[model samples]
Target: MSRLDTQIETQRLLLRVQRAEDFEYFAELQQDEEACRFIGGTAPRAAAWRKFLQMPGAWAVQGFGMFAVIEKSSGQWVGNIGPWHPEGWPGTEVGWALRRAAWGKGYAFEAAVASIDWAFDTLGWTEVIHSIDLDNVGSQELAKRLGSRNRGRGQLPAPFEDVVIDIWAQSREEWRARKR
Candidate 1:
């Protein structure tokens, strides 16, 4: 099936491959200082456009990438969450980033659960990781809630090499056990 044909639904959200129509929402999140702080700092419109395209590109090349999350009730683009592993990435990861307005609603956690399940069951991954910033307490908590513990410090590639991050992860067996 085409990548676009792939979609997963939760009680309140729809997770699917990124599409052109989602770019505006993607760019908006990229420009939100608080929302983008942990993921990457805010970007200008031009730069946001480039950054936004990376999801689809990754899906095309890698068969998996962050899914554009949509709120089922309002049918609004809420954020991005799912499998992501780029060149020189620390490991296969299940990451998340939501618009500021979507915060405090448990959307990230819900979407992340589905994403991690997909990464393991569908993608046949043995393990999953979440590379989180040191000061991003919110994400750290979310990672913990998802049954991941900080494995230790890890390095990012090139431009991000200087940035310190913690690798939070769990094996597929661990995840399956938790879900039981």
Candidate 2:
């Protein structure tokens, strides 16, 4: 197994290990209600820190997890894009989130394409899933761009009500074909 910091680089971003200092920006981003509106809602500082600390373990156990997406040009942690294994999904789910300042740019799509390609080609993952809330048009669009076809409603239930997430997925073989 490779070390956690074996940085994954794309054309414009570098997905790397989480640092303690990242939580400040991570918490800030997570606290943004608009930024997290689709997933659920933002978390408090303490909760966000807990989540950040837990990420490395997830990577250790599953060989993958949400990675801090850093913009190589400025060395800023712009977002996170990778496989998410939230309970309820039958398969491994791929998810992403970026700060509001990073929106409207091609960052999300670019990060996703790289992750999906690596998940299939390099990492040897069989398939990838996406659990996106139905009304999260931005995420839904991003999933589509990744060549994932809508599967169905997600297991993310109430307080998250009215937010019946849609599932999207693609297999390794499928992803390879799409890239050609």
Candidate 3:
């Protein structure tokens, strides 16, 4: 997925791919326990920036994408929400992770709802996927808030428990109907 450093303006947040300037803030969240707990572990600063540098041009290269989530008001980064696939999963998996401080204000729901709109309306993807760590009840609840249904078990990458992962999904038709 190629989610470059392009900026997508939402009502309250600026959803962009990622940039080097965001490294420090990005590193902080990656190192945050509550933030990275469900997302696995923190990376070394150099490694984090190396990975950060890789995001700006993926959508053009890859058929599909990932993006860095940013708050428009403060220009501060809260977390990442994007589409990442695990092997040959049917569709692009849309996922998100936000800092603990950014929680409870409905930022996740607000920005993600717009991202979902872009996925179907802009990229023209017929189906979008959602998955989260089983123990991350807050995210599971957020999926419910976004109206995705659980599709059940699957294996994720390292540090992720090989437990029952809850898969949540939405089709283009479903999303379009929801809009009307």
TM-score of 1: 0.98
**Model 2 reaches what TM-score against the true structure?**
0.89
For model 3, the stretches where C-alpha displacement exceeds 4 angstroms are: 1-5, 86-90, 157-164
The TM-scores of all predictions, comma-separated, are 0.98, 0.89, 0.85
Model 2 regions more than 4 Å off: 86-88, 156-163
Output the number of the TM-score-best candidate: 1
Per-residue lDDT of candidate 3, residues 1-180 (tens digit): 333535677788888767667778878877777777776667777777775665554555663356677887888888777665545554577778787778897888887887888777777778877866789899889888888888886666554545457678878888778779
TM-score of 3: 0.85
After TM-score superposition, the amount by which residue 174's alpha carbon in candidate 2 deviates from its true location, in angstroms, is 1.5
Alpha carbon lDDT of residue 156, candidate 1?
A: 94
lDDT of 3 at 155: 62
lDDT of 1 by residue, 70-145 (tens): 9999888999999999999999999999998899999999999999999998999999999999999999999999
lDDT of 2 by residue, 1-180 (tens): 575765778888888767776777788888999998876688988888887776677778767777888888988888778866644445776678898878987988888887777677656789998877777888888888888899887666445445666778888888888889
Output the better candidate (1/3) by lDDT.
1
- Which of 2 and 3 is ahead in lDDT? 2
- C-alpha lDDT values of all predictions: 0.93, 0.78, 0.73
